[model samples]
Target chain A: MAESTEVKLLGLWPSTYALRARIALNIKQVNYAFLEENLGAKSELLLKSNPVHMKVPVLLHGDKPICESLIIVQYIDDVWTSGPSMPPSHPYDRAIARFWAAYIDEKWGPTTKAIDAVIVAGEGEEAKKAAVDKVYDILVLLEEAFKKCSKGKAFFGGDRMGYLDMAFGSCLGWLRFREKLHDIKLLDPAKTPQLVKWAERFCEHPAVVGVMPETEQLATIEYGKGLIAKVRGANPSKW
Target chain B: MAESTEVKLLGLWPSTYALRARIALNIKQVNYAFLEENLGAKSELLLKSNPVHMKVPVLLHGDKPICESLIIVQYIDDVWTSGPSMPPSHPYDRAIARFWAAYIDEKWGPTTKAIDAVIVAGEGEEAKKAAVDKVYDILVLLEEAFKKCSKGKAFFGGDRMGYLDMAFGSCLGWLRFREKLHDIKLLDPAKTPQLVKWAERFCEHPAVVGVMPETEQLATIEYGKGLIAKVRGANPSKW
Candidate 1:
């Protein structure tokens, strides 16, 4: 338990994946050092810690490193049991939460990257519209999920912000930034009113307040452009 | 607990994903009805049970359904606590297990698919060799992982077969099938001695014995060719 204070996180400020870890740590009230990683020239510690992926955010709990964002979030929930549980209490509910979290990562993450690719390439309006439609389609399903998970409560964790909230909320910044840059409304209030309200509550939560980067800040860092660049560089055919 | 007897699984005979769930259920001694899903004409139960992916295996405990193979395995482990644990006991160990499981799914699955595609297309020997080499490269890494995870024990779960074991073990049939059809050695003993030995033990385990299909059975079903056909039909460009 004493080594809990020795926790360190390797992350990039702009990464929504990294933001998930920070938000979870804040929720658990786990004080930890944050080390910024430069993707262009990854630190030796980051490489050594997560040799497989070599991707942030890697949570160095003592000398042990946990990679992948959602995995790290679950790890935090597992290790720090004193605070509000991140995943649901029941096994069935946990499975459902995990299902959606994976859905977001697998479906939403790639779709978001596609949007970024389209935007970065300054593709035709038709392509842009198609990309935007894909995101909206996903959000429509997520709105239904929010209703089911929250059970008319304020957040996905019911009374508090938990796993699903952090999983989805981390993307809000980039979503909002994309909207601002393109003058589009991905989270259409009329179409997904509950999610809009939930998004408001999620952003305002104490654990999430300072953790998420603002839309303007994302624009300043050219996050969408940089992300697509890195992704394309890694796999040219993907984007 | 009354509903524990009401367990039902929707899966295909040849799917490694589905096999993971079956092995876990067998390990836990959970008596369950197996419902075969025809991918060409998916049943209404499969569709309704998992509306999102509409893929197998779907584990239905009473009326509740859990989709995705690994998630189902973990759910079985969670709900059926009397049996041996599937995932490792410690939180860090659990994270490591989850990490490797995801690796197998993300990396190994695709590489296997590439090999299948090359074989089914009757591609040139050079293309086939390249695909086979990719799988061998992944196996080398898994061999090292086995050493780390098993810690010189009989299985990844130490004395018993656990999460990582089932995760990788499910694919043994297909790996063996590829080796047989191509007259090559994918799990080369000289290259990945630990994995080669571990695969043998995994196949012989009580939980996995009847669950995993024989390589001959896989060849009989034309699993590799059929798999590539499905993959191509779903996403023409991926394979």
Candidate 2:
């Protein structure tokens, strides 16, 4: 056997990415030490370890530092010893899994920025409109992803929670969080109904349900309201 | 073999990423059918094949399209059943290799935008200054990347060109092209001497040298005096 090593998760409590890592570890049945971070006043260990971005969900295996959430998830999938597989095995299947994983990485940023605008933009009518447009765009994309192609599959890969599901777990948290904060229900059953169903099934999907973030973590999103508003107010041209 | 299949490459001539796929194919000694596109009037096959991005080089093996330049490189790496390895074998080494590949993807847009400013914004004093500054910022980053880390080597991974070198090959063609357009040397031996050596060696590297675009390609940059005037006249904010 290769050397056994300690696994430590350095994460922000409310981060959906952090939650994804937790669910992945639980799925692989790997026991890990969890360190909750104060994102505002990040620890010396965190700062020293991840000097490049200094972002959250830094998964440490032994002495090595893994930054970025999706990369960490991929690493976990690669490193898992005894596993009921997270990524698809065949070349085409693996390509599909990676494509969707890359898809989530590509879209999640713009979608969340949209949601942030909906809840955070204070009477800034233009920002509000942009936010609505972003949400509509994301919801439509999510709708297309679920209700269209691969419609019959339980997950992106049929009958299993593959890499795509883990990539998208970020959105599920944001969907619920945004609905509460913005006082709007974007992921309504009428629009993206299949996705809503999938999100529910995903929430209860054994490994995910047991280790997912509790409802309270969703509340912390309001902190970004002020920050995002400042960014919106600042003219991008000046930069 | 899963099925006997023909390999095809759909690409634009001046594109560096397209050149990347070309180099990888040459290195693997894989015989592939090449179809160059007229971007203004794209081919039906190109549209039907990669409807999403409609960009290239798209690697089609057995009728399956593998889009994205780096992903195509990975596919080439996987399919080159009887060729020399491009990336290292160790998991940690491969992790570092992937780190640099991913880095290039993250930096492409921002770096290219900055480079575009340098090439086209030459008409006004302020515009030229901004262009020079942008080039300096990228140069600083490349210098840091070239600096001796724990490995005591200059290349992204020591001794040999790995994933980073291959990924940077895309940037190299573009840089050389930009240098020609601007008529101001950014990566001269005087300023960035180490990087200058690295770039020279990069051009001469066995794998990279084979499919490199002609020296004349560097002379024919995609810019003009009209572009310079237009960039100078417009607000730099859009850039």
RMSD of each: 5.2, 5.9
TM-score of candidate 1 restricted to chain B? 0.89
Model 2 chain B lowest lDDT segment of ten: B220-229
Regions of candidate 2 where Cα sits further than 4 Å from its true position = A1-3, A115-153, A183-185, A188-193, A214-216, A221-239, B84-87, B118-160, B188-194, B218-239
Model 1, A16-121: lDDT tens digits are 8999999999988889999999998999999999998999999999888999999899999989887678898888888988999989989987896687678667
TM-score of chain A of each: 0.89, 0.80
> Which whole-number lDDT from 0 to 100 does residue B93 have in model 2?
56
Clashing pairs in 1: none
On DockQ, the leading prediction is 1
Question: In model 2, which residue pairs have backbone atoms overlapping below 3 Å?
Answer: none
How would the docking of model 1 be graded?
medium
Clashes of each: 0, 0
Q: What lDDT is reached at residue A123 by model 1? A: 79
Candidates, DockQ: 0.76, 0.31
